[model samples]
Target: MFFHFILIFLLISNSIQNIFKYNLFHHSHPSEPKKPSNPIVIIPGDAGSRLRANLTGKPSTVHIFCDKTTKDYFDLWLNLELFSPLIIDCWADNMRLEFNVTTGMAQELEVVLPPSRLRTMQRSFTSSALLFPSPKLWGPNETFVITPRKNYSLSNIEDFFTDIEFPQGLEQWKSESPSLIIDPPGVKVYCIYGSEVKTPEQYIWYHNWLFPDYQPYLR
Candidate 1:
Protein backbone atom coordinates (compact mmCIF):
# COMPACT_ATOMS: atom_id res chain seq x y z
CA MET A 1 0.00 0.00 0.00
CA PHE A 2 2.83 2.42 0.87
CA PHE A 3 4.59 1.65 -2.48
CA HIS A 4 1.42 2.15 -4.47
CA PHE A 5 0.78 5.56 -2.78
CA ILE A 6 4.34 6.70 -3.61
CA LEU A 7 3.89 5.81 -7.36
CA ILE A 8 0.60 7.69 -7.48
CA PHE A 9 2.21 10.78 -5.82
CA LEU A 10 5.13 10.77 -8.37
CA LEU A 11 2.72 10.59 -11.36
CA ILE A 12 0.61 13.50 -10.03
CA SER A 13 3.72 15.62 -9.31
CA ASN A 14 5.11 15.04 -12.86
CA SER A 15 1.78 15.96 -14.46
CA ILE A 16 1.53 19.22 -12.45
CA GLN A 17 5.15 20.21 -13.34
CA ASN A 18 4.49 19.58 -17.08
CA ILE A 19 1.40 21.83 -16.95
CA PHE A 20 3.37 24.58 -15.21
CA LYS A 21 6.18 24.44 -17.78
CA TYR A 22 3.69 24.58 -20.66
CA ASN A 23 1.97 27.68 -19.24
CA LEU A 24 5.28 29.39 -18.39
CA PHE A 25 6.61 29.03 -21.97
CA HIS A 26 3.52 30.54 -23.53
CA HIS A 27 3.16 33.40 -20.99
CA SER A 28 6.85 34.36 -20.90
CA HIS A 29 7.67 34.47 -24.67
CA PRO A 30 4.22 34.93 -26.19
CA SER A 31 4.19 34.68 -29.98
CA GLU A 32 1.53 36.53 -31.94
CA PRO A 33 -0.11 33.75 -33.95
CA LYS A 34 -0.06 34.33 -37.71
CA LYS A 35 -3.17 36.06 -39.01
CA PRO A 36 -4.34 37.15 -42.48
CA SER A 37 -3.37 40.74 -43.26
CA ASN A 38 -6.22 43.18 -43.02
CA PRO A 39 -6.64 45.33 -46.11
CA ILE A 40 -6.57 49.10 -45.47
CA VAL A 41 -9.72 50.84 -46.65
CA ILE A 42 -8.89 54.26 -48.05
CA ILE A 43 -11.85 56.57 -48.64
CA PRO A 44 -11.96 60.19 -49.76
CA GLY A 45 -10.21 62.48 -47.30
CA ASP A 46 -13.30 64.73 -47.10
CA ALA A 47 -15.52 61.77 -46.20
CA GLY A 48 -16.27 61.57 -42.48
CA SER A 49 -17.73 58.96 -40.12
CA ARG A 50 -20.33 61.36 -38.73
CA LEU A 51 -23.98 60.43 -39.22
CA ARG A 52 -25.62 63.56 -40.61
CA ALA A 53 -29.18 64.20 -41.74
CA ASN A 54 -29.61 66.20 -44.92
CA LEU A 55 -33.23 66.17 -45.99
CA THR A 56 -33.60 65.00 -49.58
CA GLY A 57 -37.17 66.29 -49.43
CA LYS A 58 -39.49 63.45 -50.28
CA PRO A 59 -42.80 64.13 -52.01
CA SER A 60 -44.46 62.34 -49.10
CA THR A 61 -43.64 60.32 -45.99
CA VAL A 62 -44.67 56.80 -44.95
CA HIS A 63 -45.63 57.93 -41.45
CA ILE A 64 -47.24 61.33 -41.05
CA PHE A 65 -45.41 61.82 -37.73
CA CYS A 66 -42.04 60.60 -39.06
CA ASP A 67 -39.42 63.23 -39.85
CA LYS A 68 -37.38 63.18 -43.06
CA THR A 69 -34.13 64.29 -41.50
CA THR A 70 -32.57 65.89 -38.43
CA LYS A 71 -30.96 69.33 -38.18
CA ASP A 72 -27.73 68.20 -36.47
CA TYR A 73 -25.20 65.38 -36.74
CA PHE A 74 -25.60 62.56 -34.23
CA ASP A 75 -23.61 59.45 -33.29
CA LEU A 76 -25.39 56.25 -34.27
CA TRP A 77 -24.63 52.48 -33.94
CA LEU A 78 -23.27 53.09 -30.42
CA ASN A 79 -26.53 54.69 -29.25
CA LEU A 80 -28.38 51.92 -27.39
CA GLU A 81 -31.49 53.99 -26.79
CA LEU A 82 -32.33 54.24 -30.51
CA PHE A 83 -32.99 50.48 -30.64
CA SER A 84 -35.89 50.79 -28.18
CA PRO A 85 -39.35 50.04 -29.65
CA LEU A 86 -40.74 53.43 -28.68
CA ILE A 87 -38.03 55.33 -30.54
CA ILE A 88 -37.55 52.66 -33.24
CA ASP A 89 -40.69 53.42 -35.27
CA CYS A 90 -39.73 57.03 -35.84
CA TRP A 91 -36.10 56.06 -36.48
CA ALA A 92 -37.15 53.39 -38.93
CA ASP A 93 -39.33 55.74 -40.96
CA ASN A 94 -36.41 58.12 -41.32
CA MET A 95 -34.01 55.28 -42.07
CA ARG A 96 -34.32 54.76 -45.79
CA LEU A 97 -32.16 52.83 -48.29
CA GLU A 98 -31.69 54.50 -51.67
CA PHE A 99 -29.64 52.60 -54.21
CA ASN A 100 -27.54 54.53 -56.71
CA VAL A 101 -26.68 52.48 -59.79
CA THR A 102 -23.96 54.87 -60.94
CA THR A 103 -22.03 55.04 -57.67
CA GLY A 104 -22.96 51.45 -56.81
CA MET A 105 -24.12 52.81 -53.45
CA ALA A 106 -27.48 52.77 -51.71
CA GLN A 107 -28.76 56.34 -52.07
CA GLU A 108 -32.35 57.25 -53.03
CA LEU A 109 -35.80 56.11 -52.06
CA GLU A 110 -37.71 55.74 -55.35
CA VAL A 111 -41.35 56.47 -54.66
CA VAL A 112 -43.93 57.03 -57.37
CA LEU A 113 -45.87 60.27 -56.95
CA PRO A 114 -49.11 61.19 -58.62
CA PRO A 115 -49.22 64.42 -60.62
CA SER A 116 -50.80 66.24 -57.67
CA ARG A 117 -47.92 65.54 -55.28
CA LEU A 118 -45.29 66.04 -57.99
CA ARG A 119 -46.64 69.54 -58.70
CA THR A 120 -45.62 70.83 -55.28
CA MET A 121 -42.24 69.09 -55.46
CA GLN A 122 -41.49 70.37 -58.99
CA ARG A 123 -42.05 73.99 -57.96
CA SER A 124 -39.71 73.68 -55.01
CA PHE A 125 -36.96 72.41 -57.30
CA THR A 126 -37.30 75.15 -59.95
CA SER A 127 -37.58 77.86 -57.32
CA SER A 128 -34.57 76.56 -55.46
CA ALA A 129 -32.58 76.52 -58.74
CA LEU A 130 -33.50 80.17 -59.28
CA LEU A 131 -32.49 81.11 -55.74
CA PHE A 132 -29.02 79.61 -56.17
CA PRO A 133 -27.51 80.32 -59.57
CA SER A 134 -24.74 78.11 -60.95
CA PRO A 135 -21.24 79.19 -60.06
CA LYS A 136 -19.77 81.74 -62.55
CA LEU A 137 -16.28 80.39 -61.87
CA TRP A 138 -17.05 77.65 -64.42
CA GLY A 139 -17.11 80.53 -67.01
CA PRO A 140 -20.02 82.11 -68.89
CA ASN A 141 -20.51 79.13 -71.19
CA GLU A 142 -21.52 76.08 -69.12
CA THR A 143 -22.30 73.02 -71.20
CA PHE A 144 -25.70 71.39 -70.43
CA VAL A 145 -26.15 67.84 -71.71
CA ILE A 146 -29.71 66.41 -71.59
CA THR A 147 -30.59 63.02 -73.01
CA PRO A 148 -33.84 63.23 -74.99
CA ARG A 149 -36.64 60.94 -73.90
CA LYS A 150 -37.65 58.22 -76.35
CA ASN A 151 -41.32 58.84 -75.53
CA TYR A 152 -43.10 62.14 -75.99
CA SER A 153 -42.23 64.97 -73.61
CA LEU A 154 -44.18 65.33 -70.33
CA SER A 155 -46.21 68.13 -71.94
CA ASN A 156 -47.76 65.61 -74.32
CA ILE A 157 -50.14 63.91 -71.94
CA GLU A 158 -51.82 61.72 -74.53
CA ASP A 159 -48.58 60.42 -76.05
CA PHE A 160 -46.37 60.54 -72.96
CA PHE A 161 -48.57 58.01 -71.16
CA THR A 162 -48.51 55.67 -74.21
CA ASP A 163 -51.64 53.43 -74.46
CA ILE A 164 -53.11 54.72 -71.17
CA GLU A 165 -55.90 57.25 -71.62
CA PHE A 166 -54.90 60.76 -70.60
CA PRO A 167 -56.38 61.68 -67.23
CA GLN A 168 -58.44 64.77 -68.26
CA GLY A 169 -59.89 67.70 -66.25
CA LEU A 170 -57.24 67.02 -63.54
CA GLU A 171 -55.23 70.15 -64.45
CA GLN A 172 -52.82 70.47 -67.38
CA TRP A 173 -49.66 68.34 -67.11
CA LYS A 174 -47.56 71.31 -68.35
CA SER A 175 -48.39 73.16 -65.13
CA GLU A 176 -46.56 70.44 -63.19
CA SER A 177 -43.34 71.30 -65.05
CA PRO A 178 -42.99 75.09 -65.25
CA SER A 179 -39.30 74.69 -66.08
CA LEU A 180 -40.12 72.93 -69.34
CA ILE A 181 -42.04 75.98 -70.61
CA ILE A 182 -39.85 78.68 -69.10
CA ASP A 183 -36.31 77.44 -69.50
CA PRO A 184 -33.72 79.11 -67.28
CA PRO A 185 -31.97 81.96 -69.18
CA GLY A 186 -28.60 81.08 -70.72
CA VAL A 187 -29.13 77.44 -69.72
CA LYS A 188 -29.80 75.07 -72.61
CA VAL A 189 -31.92 72.12 -71.49
CA TYR A 190 -30.87 68.65 -72.49
CA CYS A 191 -33.77 66.18 -72.24
CA ILE A 192 -32.35 62.79 -71.20
CA TYR A 193 -34.61 59.84 -70.58
CA GLY A 194 -34.26 56.09 -70.30
CA SER A 195 -36.23 54.19 -72.95
CA GLU A 196 -36.83 51.38 -70.41
CA VAL A 197 -37.97 53.28 -67.28
CA LYS A 198 -41.37 54.97 -67.21
CA THR A 199 -41.98 58.04 -65.05
CA PRO A 200 -45.39 59.55 -64.23
CA GLU A 201 -44.16 63.11 -63.85
CA GLN A 202 -41.21 65.22 -65.12
CA TYR A 203 -39.71 65.81 -61.66
CA ILE A 204 -37.70 62.56 -61.58
CA TRP A 205 -36.75 62.65 -65.26
CA TYR A 206 -34.88 65.90 -64.73
CA HIS A 207 -33.36 64.77 -61.42
CA ASN A 208 -34.81 67.80 -59.61
CA TRP A 209 -33.09 70.72 -61.33
CA LEU A 210 -32.12 71.72 -57.78
CA PHE A 211 -29.24 69.26 -58.07
CA PRO A 212 -27.46 70.95 -60.99
CA ASP A 213 -24.12 69.54 -59.88
CA TYR A 214 -25.34 66.04 -60.77
CA GLN A 215 -25.75 66.90 -64.47
CA PRO A 216 -22.14 66.13 -65.45
CA TYR A 217 -21.80 62.50 -64.38
CA LEU A 218 -25.44 61.48 -64.91
CA ARG A 219 -24.71 57.93 -66.04
Candidate 2:
Protein backbone atom coordinates (compact mmCIF):
# COMPACT_ATOMS: atom_id res chain seq x y z
CA MET A 1 0.00 0.00 0.00
CA PHE A 2 2.76 2.42 0.86
CA PHE A 3 4.54 1.52 -2.37
CA HIS A 4 1.38 2.10 -4.38
CA PHE A 5 0.96 5.56 -2.88
CA ILE A 6 4.57 6.43 -3.66
CA LEU A 7 4.08 5.27 -7.25
CA ILE A 8 0.99 7.43 -7.66
CA PHE A 9 2.87 10.42 -6.28
CA LEU A 10 5.79 9.85 -8.64
CA LEU A 11 3.50 9.54 -11.63
CA ILE A 12 1.69 12.76 -10.80
CA SER A 13 4.95 14.59 -10.19
CA ASN A 14 6.40 13.29 -13.43
CA SER A 15 3.38 14.41 -15.40
CA ILE A 16 3.62 17.94 -13.95
CA GLN A 17 7.34 18.11 -14.66
CA ASN A 18 6.87 16.98 -18.26
CA ILE A 19 4.21 19.63 -18.80
CA PHE A 20 6.50 22.30 -17.36
CA LYS A 21 9.44 21.14 -19.48
CA TYR A 22 7.37 21.04 -22.67
CA ASN A 23 6.07 24.57 -22.16
CA LEU A 24 9.48 25.87 -21.22
CA PHE A 25 11.13 24.35 -24.27
CA HIS A 26 8.49 25.64 -26.61
CA HIS A 27 8.45 29.20 -25.29
CA SER A 28 12.22 29.45 -24.98
CA HIS A 29 12.68 28.47 -28.62
CA PRO A 30 9.84 30.35 -30.27
CA SER A 31 12.18 31.60 -33.02
CA GLU A 32 12.66 28.03 -34.32
CA PRO A 33 9.91 27.14 -36.77
CA LYS A 34 8.13 24.08 -35.45
CA LYS A 35 7.20 21.85 -38.38
CA PRO A 36 5.93 18.87 -36.35
CA SER A 37 7.53 18.45 -33.00
CA ASN A 38 8.95 15.01 -32.53
CA PRO A 39 6.40 12.54 -31.22
CA ILE A 40 6.59 11.91 -27.50
CA VAL A 41 6.96 8.28 -26.52
CA ILE A 42 5.48 7.35 -23.19
CA ILE A 43 6.55 4.00 -21.78
CA PRO A 44 4.42 2.84 -18.91
CA GLY A 45 5.38 0.61 -16.02
CA ASP A 46 5.63 -3.15 -16.59
CA ALA A 47 3.25 -5.02 -18.86
CA GLY A 48 1.63 -1.83 -20.13
CA SER A 49 2.11 -2.77 -23.83
CA ARG A 50 0.27 -5.51 -25.61
CA LEU A 51 2.44 -8.41 -26.88
CA ARG A 52 1.89 -11.51 -28.97
CA ALA A 53 4.16 -14.46 -29.84
CA ASN A 54 3.13 -15.11 -33.47
CA LEU A 55 3.53 -12.03 -35.66
CA THR A 56 2.64 -13.11 -39.17
CA GLY A 57 0.14 -15.94 -38.72
CA LYS A 58 -3.06 -16.65 -36.79
CA PRO A 59 -3.03 -16.40 -32.98
CA SER A 60 -1.12 -19.18 -31.32
CA THR A 61 -1.62 -20.47 -27.78
CA VAL A 62 -0.81 -17.62 -25.40
CA HIS A 63 1.48 -19.21 -22.90
CA ILE A 64 0.11 -17.83 -19.61
CA PHE A 65 0.81 -20.85 -17.41
CA CYS A 66 4.56 -20.79 -16.85
CA ASP A 67 5.10 -24.39 -17.85
CA LYS A 68 3.81 -25.17 -14.33
CA THR A 69 0.01 -25.33 -14.28
CA THR A 70 -2.33 -26.97 -16.78
CA LYS A 71 -4.44 -25.04 -19.28
CA ASP A 72 -7.62 -25.75 -17.31
CA TYR A 73 -6.10 -24.08 -14.24
CA PHE A 74 -5.26 -21.04 -16.35
CA ASP A 75 -8.85 -20.86 -17.61
CA LEU A 76 -10.16 -21.11 -14.05
CA TRP A 77 -8.09 -18.14 -12.92
CA LEU A 78 -9.18 -16.15 -15.96
CA ASN A 79 -12.79 -16.67 -14.89
CA LEU A 80 -12.10 -15.48 -11.32
CA GLU A 81 -10.53 -12.05 -11.39
CA LEU A 82 -11.61 -11.14 -7.81
CA PHE A 83 -10.21 -14.35 -6.36
CA SER A 84 -7.03 -13.87 -8.43
CA PRO A 85 -5.62 -11.27 -6.09
CA LEU A 86 -5.45 -13.70 -3.18
CA ILE A 87 -4.10 -16.46 -5.37
CA ILE A 88 -1.44 -14.10 -6.78
CA ASP A 89 -0.30 -13.20 -3.30
CA CYS A 90 0.06 -16.87 -2.49
CA TRP A 91 1.99 -17.53 -5.69
CA ALA A 92 4.33 -14.62 -5.00
CA ASP A 93 5.06 -16.01 -1.55
CA ASN A 94 5.75 -19.42 -3.00
CA MET A 95 8.13 -17.98 -5.59
CA ARG A 96 9.94 -15.95 -2.95
CA LEU A 97 10.39 -18.99 -0.78
CA GLU A 98 11.58 -21.00 -3.73
CA PHE A 99 14.23 -18.41 -4.56
CA ASN A 100 15.45 -17.96 -0.98
CA VAL A 101 15.77 -21.68 -0.33
CA THR A 102 17.59 -22.39 -3.59
CA THR A 103 19.92 -19.38 -3.60
CA GLY A 104 20.60 -19.51 0.12
CA MET A 105 21.65 -23.12 -0.14
CA ALA A 106 23.96 -22.35 -3.07
CA GLN A 107 25.51 -19.38 -1.30
CA GLU A 108 26.20 -21.36 1.87
CA LEU A 109 27.95 -24.10 -0.09
CA GLU A 110 29.89 -21.58 -2.25
CA VAL A 111 28.98 -23.54 -5.37
CA VAL A 112 26.87 -23.09 -8.49
CA LEU A 113 23.15 -23.74 -8.25
CA PRO A 114 21.59 -26.77 -9.96
CA PRO A 115 20.01 -26.46 -13.39
CA SER A 116 16.53 -27.43 -12.12
CA ARG A 117 16.50 -24.68 -9.49
CA LEU A 118 17.75 -22.22 -12.12
CA ARG A 119 14.89 -23.26 -14.35
CA THR A 120 12.46 -22.73 -11.50
CA MET A 121 13.87 -19.26 -10.93
CA GLN A 122 13.45 -18.42 -14.61
CA ARG A 123 9.85 -19.58 -14.53
CA SER A 124 9.20 -17.50 -11.41
CA PHE A 125 10.58 -14.42 -13.16
CA THR A 126 8.02 -14.78 -15.95
CA SER A 127 5.15 -14.82 -13.45
CA SER A 128 4.99 -11.05 -13.52
CA ALA A 129 6.13 -10.47 -17.12
CA LEU A 130 2.64 -9.76 -18.50
CA LEU A 131 -0.28 -7.94 -16.96
CA PHE A 132 -3.41 -8.92 -18.88
CA PRO A 133 -2.84 -12.50 -17.86
CA SER A 134 -3.93 -11.70 -14.33
CA PRO A 135 -3.75 -13.54 -10.96
CA LYS A 136 0.06 -13.61 -11.54
CA LEU A 137 -0.12 -17.22 -12.65
CA TRP A 138 -3.15 -17.85 -14.87
CA GLY A 139 -4.56 -15.62 -17.64
CA PRO A 140 -5.35 -15.60 -21.34
CA ASN A 141 -3.22 -14.68 -24.30
CA GLU A 142 -3.46 -11.01 -25.34
CA THR A 143 -5.35 -11.97 -28.48
CA PHE A 144 -7.18 -15.13 -27.41
CA VAL A 145 -10.05 -13.56 -25.48
CA ILE A 146 -11.42 -11.51 -28.36
CA THR A 147 -14.46 -12.84 -30.17
CA PRO A 148 -13.92 -13.27 -33.92
CA ARG A 149 -10.34 -12.74 -32.95
CA LYS A 150 -8.55 -10.23 -35.15
CA ASN A 151 -5.57 -11.53 -37.11
CA TYR A 152 -2.90 -11.65 -34.39
CA SER A 153 0.51 -10.83 -35.79
CA LEU A 154 3.68 -9.55 -34.21
CA SER A 155 4.34 -7.24 -37.18
CA ASN A 156 1.11 -5.43 -36.42
CA ILE A 157 2.28 -4.66 -32.90
CA GLU A 158 6.05 -4.34 -33.40
CA ASP A 159 5.99 -0.59 -34.01
CA PHE A 160 4.74 0.13 -30.49
CA PHE A 161 5.29 -3.08 -28.51
CA THR A 162 8.93 -3.34 -27.60
CA ASP A 163 10.42 -5.21 -24.65
CA ILE A 164 12.98 -3.86 -22.21
CA GLU A 165 15.85 -6.34 -22.47
CA PHE A 166 17.37 -5.33 -19.13
CA PRO A 167 21.14 -4.76 -18.94
CA GLN A 168 21.45 -5.46 -22.64
CA GLY A 169 18.80 -2.90 -23.48
CA LEU A 170 20.44 -0.39 -21.18
CA GLU A 171 23.85 -1.00 -22.68
CA GLN A 172 22.51 -0.74 -26.22
CA TRP A 173 20.73 2.49 -25.46
CA LYS A 174 23.91 3.95 -23.99
CA SER A 175 26.10 2.87 -26.93
CA GLU A 176 23.62 3.97 -29.58
CA SER A 177 23.06 7.35 -27.97
CA PRO A 178 19.67 9.04 -28.57
CA SER A 179 18.32 7.32 -31.66
CA LEU A 180 15.43 5.33 -30.18
CA ILE A 181 13.13 7.35 -32.40
CA ILE A 182 13.55 8.45 -36.03
CA ASP A 183 12.57 11.74 -37.71
CA PRO A 184 13.76 13.43 -34.49
CA PRO A 185 17.43 14.40 -34.37
CA GLY A 186 17.79 13.91 -30.63
CA VAL A 187 15.20 12.20 -28.44
CA LYS A 188 14.82 13.71 -25.01
CA VAL A 189 14.63 10.81 -22.59
CA TYR A 190 13.27 11.01 -19.06
CA CYS A 191 13.62 8.50 -16.29
CA ILE A 192 10.79 9.00 -13.83
CA TYR A 193 10.59 6.41 -11.09
CA GLY A 194 8.93 5.95 -7.74
CA SER A 195 10.98 6.09 -4.53
CA GLU A 196 9.87 2.57 -3.74
CA VAL A 197 11.40 1.12 -6.89
CA LYS A 198 14.75 -0.43 -6.08
CA THR A 199 17.78 0.90 -8.00
CA PRO A 200 21.49 0.64 -7.44
CA GLU A 201 23.02 3.59 -5.60
CA GLN A 202 25.81 3.91 -8.17
CA TYR A 203 23.29 3.94 -11.00
CA ILE A 204 21.35 6.68 -9.22
CA TRP A 205 24.55 8.70 -8.95
CA TYR A 206 25.25 8.22 -12.63
CA HIS A 207 21.73 9.27 -13.53
CA ASN A 208 21.87 12.40 -11.35
CA TRP A 209 25.43 13.61 -11.82
CA LEU A 210 27.25 11.89 -14.66
CA PHE A 211 24.76 10.81 -17.30
CA PRO A 212 23.88 13.25 -20.04
CA ASP A 213 22.45 16.09 -17.94
CA TYR A 214 19.54 13.95 -16.78
CA GLN A 215 18.79 15.77 -13.54
CA PRO A 216 16.57 18.38 -15.14
CA TYR A 217 14.60 15.75 -17.06
CA LEU A 218 14.22 13.27 -14.21
CA ARG A 219 11.43 13.80 -11.68
- How much lDDT does each candidate structure score? 0.44, 0.34
- Lowest lDDT block of 10, candidate 2: 49-58
lDDT of 1 by residue, 1-219 (tens): 999768756765666666677667745334667657789787632222233345556566665555666576454332334443334555555555767789999874443543544444444443334322123322223323332343333233344333223333113433333334344678676988779775222222354342322322332
lDDT of 1 at 83: 41
Best candidate (score: lDDT): 1
lDDT of model 1 at residue 68? 62
Spell out the clash pairs found in candidate 2. 55-153, 55-154
Candidate 2: where is the Cα deviation over 4 Å?
1-85, 88-97, 100-219
- Which 10 consecutive positions of candidate 1 have the poorest summed lDDT? 131-140
Per model, state how many residue pairs clash: 8, 2
